[model samples]
Target: INEDSYGVDDEEEFHELDMTGRVIANNYRIESKLGAGSFGQVYLCEHVRTHEQWAMKIESHAMNNNPQLSIE
Candidate 1:
């Protein structure tokens, strides 16, 4: 059976901590969780000024512990 990945790339995966309702870099505010994976998690954030929504990926410490990890 042939499976389609919808152009998804595992090498481009992201990981991050959940920062719900928290502001970062004095620019954007984390809102909610979008998804997660073995490496990290993704969150939904918004711009403080324009209120534009964005998807952010955060790599976890465990992922960084491994030298083979993709995220630096």
Candidate 2:
């Protein structure tokens, strides 16, 4: 599926981090972006060993400076 299928536009100004194809926490491999908003982006990820998929919500650091809103 293309970006249009996910309602994402290439011309939009987004602050979400692009983590697709990257491994997180040394286990979860990021697959694709599911959705994004003013807060952050959600990604479809998979467990490298078990192949279990999960949705991970990651906040955009460029949006705000409040420490409470950060996932890191």
Candidate 3:
């Protein structure tokens, strides 16, 4: 699910890098933030249906925000 949406890697696996409490795919609810970095951050999330917990990694997508890169 966490591939690359709008240059943001919202979800991956065992490393949900989004670092947010926002729900993804209408399933996982981001519980809290574990850590952060230039690439992304890890998040604690819970499954809405089964009441499961997991760590999700999300990419920061800092590359797209570069000052030099721009679309004409």
Which candidate should be chosen as best, given lDDT against the real structure? 2
lDDT of 1 at 19: 53
Backbone clashes counted, model 1: 4
lDDT of 1 at 48: 97
Count of backbone collisions in candidate 3: 9
Please provide, for model 3 over 1-72, each residue's C-alpha lDDT reduced to its tens digit, 9 standing for 90 to 100: 454563433334324434365788899998989886555566789999998999876554554465543531
True-structure RMSD, every candidate: 12.5, 7.9, 9.9
Task: Compose the digit string of candidate 1's lDDT tens values, residues 1-72.
Answer: 011221334534323233588776787788999888776667789999999999876655445567756443
Compared with the true structure, all predictions reach lDDT values of 0.64, 0.68, 0.64
Better of 1 and 2 by lDDT: 2
Clashing pairs in 3: 2-11, 15-56, 15-57, 16-56, 16-57, 16-58, 17-57, 17-58, 18-58
Q: Candidate 3: minimum summed lDDT over ten consecutive residues — where?
A: 6-15
Winner by TM-score? 2
Q: How many clashes in each candidate?
A: 4, 0, 9
lDDT of 1 at 57: 65
